[model samples]
Target: MNKQEYMNCAEEELLHTYNRFPVVLERGEGVYLYDTDGKKYLDFAAGIAVSAFGYGKKEYNDALKAQIDKVIHTSNLYYNTPVIEAAKKALAASGMDRIFFTNSGTEAIEGAMKAAKKYAYTRDGHAGHEIIAMNHAFHGRSLGALSITGTRHYQEPFEPLIPGVRFAEYNDLDSVKKQITEKTCAIFLETVQGEGGIYPAEKEFIEGIRKICDEHDILMVTDEIQCGMGRTGKMFAWQHYDVKPDIMTCAKAFGCGVPVGAFLMTEKAAEKSLVPGDHGTTYGGNPLVGAAVSTVFDLMEKENILEHVQEVAPYLEHALDALVEKYEFVSARRGLGLMQGLVLNVPVGKAAAKALEEGLIIITAGSDVLRFVPPLIIEKSHVDEMAEKLDKVFAQIEA
Candidate 1:
């Protein structure tokens, strides 16, 4: 069937959750994707920053294939080699003492909340502990994750969400402090806010949050789901600020395209929270995703992905800045490393549709920001190609 036919079929059977683009992506290689109509697109979205190693890496694919032959899954009741290896590498990378794997970023957030609440309960011998999250922050779509998400529209329809989550202003330390009370057990924020536009947390603001958490004995949780795993030229964005979170939630590129996520905590938090029966998942740490997670970390080291990002990210930032300078509608460029955004006065949705027509795949964040989160494997040439395509897009839009 053709692209439209496939889309029609999908629309008939599948729930219409996403206002999907017209193209039907067939496959990807390196930093490019191809649609069913045999059109090529220079990918800047990286499947929303999940394809760290790009489309197909021989090493990563071989690891999954080999693991499939050995064992695809085993109950959490039994020990598995791949999960054990993944746990060790993840712990070392995050400098956290304990880890709980989940199937997605939302589940990781849920687990983190549970751990924080359990820690508070264990400490005070009571419940009803609250959590403070930043306004405009986007955690996830699940009930527990959505409750902590600060956006009102997303939560209004799903009314009466899990209560006790207070919204604070992003990068405003005073706002966070004002929300804290005896019942505040945890503070959650994205090290770099993704869906709310590409706003990197200010160093002072993140450090201040850390200090507040330390003084108040509250667990600091950084949502690294969108900015972690070498996307920010560091293993984690919080590392750049030298602020360690008591609980860190990671996904996205953590498994480099596989369905896996984890919430890691310090030894102190671990000792006081989420004992055996407190949390469990049948497929969370199964060997299939375990192999994917372990191989992702291994390839990150063997290929020096972080170093590549460090070198190329500045070039991307510079190129985006040039567009801002050249175009009247382009207002500014903001973000860290490869996760950048170009703010525009025009409609971002129309611009994105035009980009797709120009054989480029880009996405938007917030309402007016053109989000550029290319694969970690992207080169300077890919950035150049993206700039060229965007230049045409801007020109066409201006016309």
Candidate 2:
């Protein structure tokens, strides 16, 4: 279909749920996308940080196809080989004993929250079931995750959310310390805050969370949905800090584009938390997604994905930093690895729209930060193309 056809379908027939860019992505390859009009654009957003191994990875395709031929969905009531194997790989990589798979990132957050509070309640009592999250942290859109999102805009419309939730300043050790009372059950945070302008957790702050959780006997949960799985030049972002969360939630790039989410917990935490028949979904951990997930982890091991990011990230960072010098609108560039953000003096949405019109795909976060989350397989040449297009976009932005 053409762009006009899609626009008509969207404006007339579809629900006004998303604030989308004025373009229809028809097809994609590694680091590039074709719009409905056949215009090729340098894809820097990577489907909002989902296409981990880049578009059209043969191994992932093969794994998925093989599973599709066998069985796609056989209700979660019985055991399935692909799901079991995938669980093994995901659990091993996460450094946790047990895991519960879900359909999306929000479901993963809900499961993690339930497990955290359940474990705390089972251990002592229900009074100590409070959850403390960071300000500007984005977990997911589910009611449970939204309850602890710490963003007023996403929470205002849906009031009377989950109880025993409080917000603390991100990367502030003192804020965390003051909030963790006797009622605190889980102290949740993103290893590298993705929607909070790509701010990584300070080492001292993470270590402080670990110490405080230990002292209060509360659960430390890291939401690595966007920052995990070699995105930050590490398999898990928490590995950058000297902290191992009692529970961890991850999704987005886990299946290399397939919809899959997982939450893992330590033995003590898992023991008191989830049990058989306590929670599940019909499609969660289905064989098809399991095969794809197994393939992704296997490739992550053999290909040394993090090492590749370590080599290529510096060049991309330098290129984006150079943009700040050339364009007055770009204020700063910040992030650890591939998940970098371009903080702008001008409005990020306007700059992103300009980039889209100029044959580039980018995203915007809170405030004026333009997000750049290209696939990890992106090379220096792709980075150069992105920089040139984004430079023009920034130059055209009204300052």
Candidate 3:
């Protein structure tokens, strides 16, 4: 059917949870998506940083197909080979001791929260189960993750959230220190705050947090759902800081196009999380998602995915920088790899709509900051074309 018909049907039948755009994408390939009417748009957002493998890759498709033929799922009761392999790769990639898989990024954050608080509460008693999160952070919409996301715009509507979540100013270690009292159980942060306008944590800031965590005995948890999995030119963004977290939550791009999530932790936290079924998910480690995840690692290593991100992402960043330098409307440019941003001096919602009208898909982070999370496979030529289009678009914005 046509785009209008599809949207009308969805509006009538589907849940009104999302405020969707007008375009109804029918298919995607590489870094482009085609609407039902065959109109193509440069997929700059890359499904909100979830389509790391790009639109359709043969390896991912083949792996998923093979799994579909064999067995889609088996409960957590039985051992699933693909799930076991996925856990192995994920643990090795994170350099963490254990993992608990889930169904989405928020679920991963929820699991991370539980693991962090439990790690502290059981060890030092319940009174110390407080978490310190950054200002303007965006973890997820779940109750627990929502409680830690420092943006009140998202949390104000859903009040009466979990307590003990202290908001520290982003990139300010002094603020963090002031908030981290004896009751603090963890310091949870995004390695690069994706929804906080793509702000990367200062190296010194992260080091200070690590030091504080050590001194105060608080777990340091970094949410890498949007920044990890080669989105930041590294396997994990925390690696760039020369520091590791006590716990890490990763999802979004982990299963390629499929739905999955995982929260990993150090050996210390993993050992204590065992309360004889304290936490579990029906599809946590489902073999089908594991199959897709297993192939992701194979592709990551074989294709030198991180190397490609390093090589190509510079072009993407340079493109955005060129626009920022040329246009006064762009206030700032930040973020690593393809997870870059163009901080518009004005509200980005209109600019994003204009972008979609111009056959490009982009997303806004915090207010005026426009996020660009293109597919990992995007090349230099794609970068040049996108930059030119964006330059032309911004020029029209002034007119």
Off by over 4 Å in 3: none
lDDT tens string, model 1, 28-102?
888999999899999999999999988978999999999999999888999999999999999998889999999
The alpha-carbon deviation from the true structure for residue 189 of candidate 3, after best TM-score superposition, in angstroms, is: 0.3
TM-score of each: 0.99, 0.97, 0.98
Order the candidates by TM-score, highest first: 1, 3, 2
Residue range 1-399, candidate 2, lDDT tens digits: 678888879988888999888888888877788987889988888888888887878878988998899999988888999878888988788788988888888898999998988888887856447899999999988789999898899999988889889899998999888887777889999998888798988899999999998988889999999998889998899988867999998888888788998898899899898788778898989988889888988999888889999999999999999988877667888999999998887778888889888898889888879998889998999898888887777666643
Residues 117-221 of candidate 3 have per-residue lDDT tens digits of 787767875644689999999999988889999998899999999988899998999999889677888899999999889999999999999999898877899
* Count: clashes, candidate 1: 0
Off by over 4 Å in 1: none
Candidate 1 clashing pairs, residues 3+ apart or interchain: none
Clashes in predicted model 2: 0
On lDDT, the leading prediction is: 1
lDDT sort, best first: 1, 3, 2
* Steric collisions counted per model: 0, 0, 0
